[model samples]
Target: MIRNTDLYTIAQSGLRASNTLLDTTGHNIANVNTEGYVRERTTFVTQLYGGVGRGTTERVINTFAQNQLRRDITEVGEHEIYSQRTSTVDNLFASEANSISKALSRFYASIQTATDEPTNMAARQLVLGEANSLVGQVGTMSEFLKTKEEELNLELESTINRANSLIESIAKLNDKIRVLEANNSYEEPGALKNERDKAIRDLAEIMSIETRQSGNDDGITMVNLTSGESLVLEDGTFNLFGLNGNPDIQYKNLELRSTGKPTSLRLAEVDVGGKMGGLFRYRSEVLDPARRELGQIALSMAAAMNEQNRLGMDYDQQLGSNIFQLPTVSGLNYAANSSLALTANARVSEDGARDLTSADYQVTIDAVTPGAPPTLDVTVALLNPDGSPVTDTAGTPITQTYTGLTAQAGTFEKVLGGIEIEFPDGAGYAVGDQFLFQPTKDAAADLEVQMTRPEDIALASPFRVDASINNFGDAELVSTTVTNTVVDNTAPFDPDTSAFDGAGGIQGPGVAPGGLVGAPASVVFTSATSYEVRDSANNVIVTVAGATDLNNLLQQAKGAPGYPAAWTALNDYPGYDFSLQGVPKAGDTFNISYNTDGLNDNRNGLELANLQNKDVVLSSNNGTTSRFSFQEKYANIVSDIGEKAAVADISLKAAEAMKDQSKNWFESVSGVSLDEEAANLVRYQQTYAASARVLTTAQTLFDTILGAVR
Candidate 1:
């Protein structure tokens, strides 16, 4: 059992095992700085009962740690991109020079000064200057947002290209790896396999991916996008493509298709995560909303100012014209039918401006047949910044349905949210026809001052009251004022411009249809509280029945006959409501007409300046609608971006820390450490020396036996 020859053979096996350990140690030391190189170790086994067997070399790796590292890497990648982009916008709004708030404040201050000096041309010029400055600021911010969106598009294109390259590289590696595994090339993972792992990690930096082994022992990796699609299978690779534009053509859309195939799949931005996710996320969450908010501010402000200026008489005496041309936006058609002639648009009225939010909308033609128009109904839904359907408070989709709208080409139908989803009644629409409307998207750039001359600014009301010396009655027209502008029309519509501007002034409040221009309207009190309003022709236009109080009488007069059901008057379908005080004898008469010489009257200017504090900017709070002043709205925009940036910053820190921790655990198991390798080298060298000594002793004993036998 203990023969010298047997001992020599066992010693020889020990020496071989120690030599393999030394070689593995040296290999590890040599690759200590190599990326993804797993440490190698020599494992020895015994043969039968006594002698040592050949050594097996295998890589040191932990599957859990590698997966954890991959997850952390993906998270860090997304946060890094999102944080940087969000901070850019946050910093822009935080600056005083770039902020819309400062310019807006200065703009309103100029108007405040003009109201005090109603006839001053210098004050009016200052107002125009401030308006230009404010417009410039809005344009600058909008341009910045557009630039950011363009930059994101470029980034997406680059990301897709790089991802495709990595995918191809991984597929190639898979092909080589499967070949090697098939031939039993190595006892453990070889350099090619490690290189493939590193390539996959790089891919993970762009998108969320999950890796798994082949179930049938293919030895090739299968990568899942984690967004519910297989990115790479054991046998095939998929490539990502960026469509040049989406429905609006403002940015790119991502798609996926197999290599060498025409069939493709569209990827939703919301469903994706990683660096690509970060870029789209910042665009949707920060830049888009910020741009929309800026446009809304510009649009709403312009509408309000234009409305008030139109209600006043300019120093030129001709009815004040539009001070600023209303911002016009035509809806974009999508998924169009070649024969569908229907189109859509939006308009915000002076009053409706307060109801406008920066949300995007879609008008869909349901029941659309190839040759017949959709007359049954249309679906309108508010969209998120990412073009996703906005949900209601109960989480159900908030879709506004309008029925019985005609499908007639060239005809217009009104829909919710001031949207004119007009189409003819009976013309067929193409299948999947729809329209996209962004009410304020273009306002910042499209807004223009329609007036250049300071004399064009309106600072006087068109109506005034006087104490009639012709009336022997003791009633006096004490301190009369114009509460709101008048609109005298059967079907009043302000789709774009002010309905009451220009020729609209020819029919002042209480003026009959086609009445003489600038004629005084009369109100003769039948009783102390009961008065019948009449025009120059003495046509009874408004009648009060039982009025104990002037304010109460005004409310009761809202049900006045001869008015249409869809009236848009300032007070209960009336152009303006009157507030009369004191006791007046029956048959007392007072007249109301244009304040042509009202140069000293700044009442309209006061009202216009007061618009600065009006609740005209629409906002949402907990699913309820609330209106904010321009300042509050602008401040909200700045704060929202700031909050998102802070969140992105925090997310980055968390993601990086997690990645570092996971990397530490992974490196401990598979990564080669120079110090550890050096120690192993020394240990293996000593073991080899001891093993050689054993071999030498075995040789001596065998030689002794051989000499003895001789």
Candidate 2:
């Protein structure tokens, strides 16, 4: 016969296990939408088997899949964060580049207008106005870039703070989980695990990380990220935290709480690869390089333009003066040294004067030997400034050979007017006097110069003049006729008489009194003979004439056929085409000087243009103009984000599919469908009713037996 007690024990144990399974299913359904919540399952085992024991129900949950899901979730979080950051920065660059392009267009338009009306005041003013706007735009754009960098800094700080908080929370969970698992708690503490997983996901956004479960403790876990360093220990404490300060992301180093000192972390040294790794790589390499390149462009443009502006220019017939205003940029001052030489060719005058057109001259200055005489070579050019060969008024090409050439060391002083050439040791000069050089019999000349000076020729006063007049003539004195034999005090006209002689004939005062002479009524004089002044070496000395005032002379000289053009050429000229081809290594310095007149006179604009082209290179530095195009950079950022988003979406979808598969599989093994649960409920109810009926029968039999015994 079946024992009633054994049946009760079996039914009760089955009921308890079923109830637990039902609770677990309800928990999973309720928290389905919760982030980081992994579906849970109850674990059960058959009770101790007794004699004639029937089989009991049991269920077991899969924890390995839950752990893998946690890791994937962290990766998804990190990828999202990095994608957002790069996208933000890329957008900023796109905006800035577009603004720069607009400014460039406006500048070009102004230039076109200037070209149309070169001499129009309104046109010139418009050009200047547009230039001002362009410069302002550059400055504003630079400021905006700096502002964006500041924003990044703030974002970094916040990220670090949030990471630290998450890490602390994670450590706390670690401790709680270790204790709960050890105690074999009926409650799996699934909520705490979910929170911990969320924290790990948050941390992954800042840095790529890896997790390892501790072999010593079921709940203990270790976190390893970039730089091959342990971020968290198995002992439920964080070993690593980020420093909060400026957003020098490139120099980001983790600080160990135990040491309280920052440790260098090189992503390159670590194999940890993820979205956080991508962000670190971008921060350290791409973004930083872009910023540096922009700074270099700004500094080079500013310095070069400023140097050119300082050269000054003449406008509206005025003397040379600064043409452009330059802004001072901190930490970008350039120490410049330049050497220049001035030379001129002789040309003939139409008035039968000595022609300077054929006389070729050379001038040289060396910076290394400032006071030393420069090497000079002279050559005559057959052509004029108009690129046509020189011809006399007779339509025949006239040529002349220079004679009595001489050269000596001279002190060249640059004054406001121009460069003043002085004799060496001040020997060939007189107080308040001047000297000049004239060419032979031609009207056109060519001059060449070799400069060795380290500094630019400082132009001071332009011209000098001296004027004095003297007269030579015969003279006679007359007195009224006095018959009285009185001594006539009037001097008499005598060409051969001495003033001190007392002869009876009238004596002329020595060469007229006070060295003065009166004009004769009518007299024929011979033509004045031309005389030439020569230096020690018999070279004819020439004097520059016209414009007695220095300032006027400078103004007139500025745009003159030869001298002015030469001066303008030097104003902003970039000296010789020097090459670094011969330079072997760093710390090597070379000295070179060339005629600036051969180059552009306005160097500021040229330098600015050169900077735009990335032509100016610092010593030991190479500059690159290859920048990420708007479309390219933006596309890269967008593509990266889209890829990660897609991957995350796909991963979540796959996880969902897997969960469904696991649910179906689990249902086949242990899950209770509505139909099956209902059937089991009915079967259990019937069994309970049958047991009650059996008990009633037994009671009736016992009562009958007891009555018979009574």
Candidate 3:
């Protein structure tokens, strides 16, 4: 073992190892600024026979740091997308010129001007012009919002395709690495692994994914979605398909499927935490809700204007018709519904005038009777936004039973918002049938001005109260207001409507009659504290007593419980009320009749103008209520969207900070360091020189020994 030839071999191995080490250090310095290049290292081990052995090149990759970077990078992607998208929506709502609040304010202001001057054509035309302006503004905003939705779909589609391509790329890289490693004695090239990691990191920008290296095939990484669905194997990709969305087809639903698998799954019903998830979250939280809230305010405004106008008389001496055409919505059948013949038709409640909301609801049908029944009862319950049953404050599901519902033979059998269950004879509604009700979705876009001319504006009250001059004793009229008046309308003014609840629920007809019943009547005061309401027959029909003054007597007349049947009937008829101020002697008569020639009466116009401040929008059946005017509701939308935008911005900044920190951590472990590489290069250069000296010495010794042998 101590021979000169052994020394030569030893010197040769040392020179070879030193030269390889210098080459590896130079390579590290050369690729120090390269993208996706991990620092390469080699181990020099001494064999049992004392010669140096070169080990395989390995990458100094910190797996935990790499994974943490991917996670933080996905969060950055999600919040960046969310904040950017939410800012756009926020600006749309916050802008004063484009906001619904400004338009609604101007529209109501014009109505107030018209109310002050009922006979002025200029004022009436101003109202019409402002209404048209409001309608145009809302229409433009609605179309813009619709286009945003379309753009969102396209963005999502492009993102999905881009993600699928990256996944495929990663899978191919996996295959290449596996093949190369298998052919190279199971030692993968560090550069090839670098490329695979880059692909997965790129995929993380699109969506959150879990990755694990499989030791079975020389450490190939397997990728999966947040749903735990396998996305990438060692050599193949599980791609996603963009299918039509349920309830809304303009959007798309993601379907994840393996390359060779027959089955597929919806790529997560919950948040997946990336750009796609950000878009989806924005749609539900900001876009759809804000759009619906705007529509709701507009719809409520239109309904109030139309209904109030219909309650009065126009300049043409006819009952005022609707000022705006109301928007209508139909119930959308859920994809899981099995009733092919049944149709769940829907509309706004009370003919689009009262008790309407902007919330998306899921209507579930609970069939209380079998298909074969003389009386088939079905209860429709509106559930939460995501189609779960609504719970009460006490955490109990508040169930209201709709009993004694006899099935009729028409399109309106078992009706709720005109839901038709026209099955064959003796067939009833299917149990568990569900429908999605976006009642105010298209309300703003579909709103139209129905009033054609200035004279169509109803400004004159339908009734007039006149104090008689014959036997009155200084009893003065303080105020006279036509609170309610029976006019010729297309439909009867029944509070219950004798019509099914159009909010996708069923109830029986109310005890009150459908049509308002009253005739022309008069109230005659017999004393300062007593009055008798007589029909047009001039005979006393309603007698009231036990009042200290005329105002108190009027107050007593308002309540229907303690009063006689004739008193209640007479007071309710004509739907008018009056108050007196001073004292009055006996036999003070007030005549109430139709105001046939009251062309300049602006009382009803003032009443309609009062609707501007009415607390009427976004109604619910809860005991506690908080209603708002039109502008307030629109402002609420702006505030809500702005809040979401602010939150997203804050979250985005935080995520980006975490992402940078993780990147730094990964870089510190696996990234190339020029200083370290330069030091190694110098050390290896010294070793190379020393080994060369040894070879030279061994060569000189061998030559000397050869000379001596000769």
Candidate 4:
């Protein structure tokens, strides 16, 4: 038979379990609003003698829900940062009235006014004033972007400090939790683990992170930053963090190292995330690119306008000077010293003068083998606006590699992007040395109107051309003028068709023109509809095969009556134009020669004014593409930024939805409910009361038996 003592012990055990259950429920209710707190549940195990009886109660928790929640939170954080930064840039560029578009229109309108009244002092003054305003506007925007970059740098530093602080705090908590867990004191150390987890979640808000729990149950949690770089190890050691570069001109990068390591590694090598990651994205994708594109427009306008100005004579009959001055190209060295020298120059390509992109290039001296026979390799990589390497459609990096560089240093020509990189042979390049080329990065800031006097504005052509006076036929030269020599090599010239591909060639893509730019030419008529354009040496530059009328013949050079034919510019030779008022007989020849009139010729200014519609900007791939105007390029930039901002906003909304859903799932599994906690309180109270009654009954029975024995 079971002893009365055993019965008393069972009742006492039941009472204690009920009391503990009540306490656990109350604790959950108390911390329902606490962040990162998981609801704790009391579980009872039955101890059997002859019958079942209540034994001990323990606390239980679900780790899976907590891990999922952390991951969702990290994704939400990344999207938020990206969305906010892009929105700022989008707003900055979206305005049309006060933005670059408006400024360009005003400046061009002023130029038109000056073109209409070439001798008007007031119109000329307005042109100079508008040019100054345009440059000022560019400078203001550039400075604003620079200011934004500095602000991001400050934010980055603060974020780094916060990340480091959380890392250290978690490591300290790890030490405490490990000691307590080792001693099997789960009750007190559970709170410490909660604190550490909160720290992890906070750190995740600033960057992407991955965590794992140790199998040994020593309370160790490992954390890895972007792309599997160790942040906090399982043994409780966290990596140290540092920064490199000034951040203002970019190249500011995160550095990381283990506690025991002497050197730090670049964070860019790893996939970085969080607030710091967003800053990097903003700097490279928005800030740096805006500045570069601005500079590219400034450079294109200044270079082309000034070159055309130089081709004309000033009002006083003197040669024209630059209207706007800036560097031909912009370049920077990774490490600058007195011994280091470099030149990165860019010019309009002969093909079409298509506009170059704002993208930068990296030149690196890599893979050096030093010995009796030293060998070095040079590699160049084209970078996207975000500072990431550009790739082909198949995702391979678009890189050019040159081997067997025996010369110490020389100009590297034949490189794409219409640029030449020159290095001084003295203090030759070292292995691993890198140079960055930002061809138009500083153009806006460096632009200035070099001309001071109104009389200095080149409004007249420096050279003139006239038809041969000895032509013997009904053919008579009607008019002559210079045309812009920049021709599109890809544009087909067909006399039968009214339309012409100004930059495209009839043969195929990128075909070189046969005519020489600025060279004199002679037009010899084989018949009324046929003529051959010859250079000074009598070599045929292009032959006009079929022409129905004078207008058709002038517009298109056809191979046959209906077939489209390629025609080179008679002189890419915009110095002059020859015209025939009447039909010309066969064997009648017209000689086109440069004009000696420099003072009273406004032909060059008129040609320069026509450049507003000419495609003179070079692109990344289109060498002779002349489609986009300077204003059009700025318009494209505005559109692209707006689209990116919209995409970022959409992504942010989606991420937020995912985060909310994850939190809801976690709450369903582990969140404390007030209604449930209240029900548990009442149930446990009743259990305690019932257990007391059982103990009293057993005691009463024992007392009665003792009295009977007495």
Off by over 4 Å in 3: 1-5, 183-186, 215-217, 233-244, 251-255, 258-260, 267-270, 339-344, 350-354, 365-432, 471-520, 539-541, 547-585, 619-625
lDDT tens digits, residues 583-701, model 3? 66788888766667788888789888888788777533342336788877787788889999999999999999999999999999888888888889889999999989988998999
lDDT of 4: 0.65
TM per prediction = 0.87, 0.48, 0.84, 0.77
Over 494-601, each residue of candidate 4 has an lDDT whose tens digit, in order, gives 222211122211112233333232133567889887887655566565678666665423334333342212233232322334456688888778765333344445
Question: What is the C-alpha local distance difference test score of each model?
Answer: 0.73, 0.38, 0.70, 0.65
lDDT (Cα, tens digit) per residue for candidate 2, span 244-268: 2211232343343432344543324
Best-to-worst order by lDDT is 1, 3, 4, 2
Q: Cα lDDT of model 1 overall?
A: 0.73
What's the CA RMSD for each of the models? 4.3, 25.3, 5.9, 8.6
Comparing 3 with 4 on TM-score, the higher-scoring candidate is: 3
Count of clashing pairs, candidate 1: 9
Better of 1 and 4 by lDDT: 1
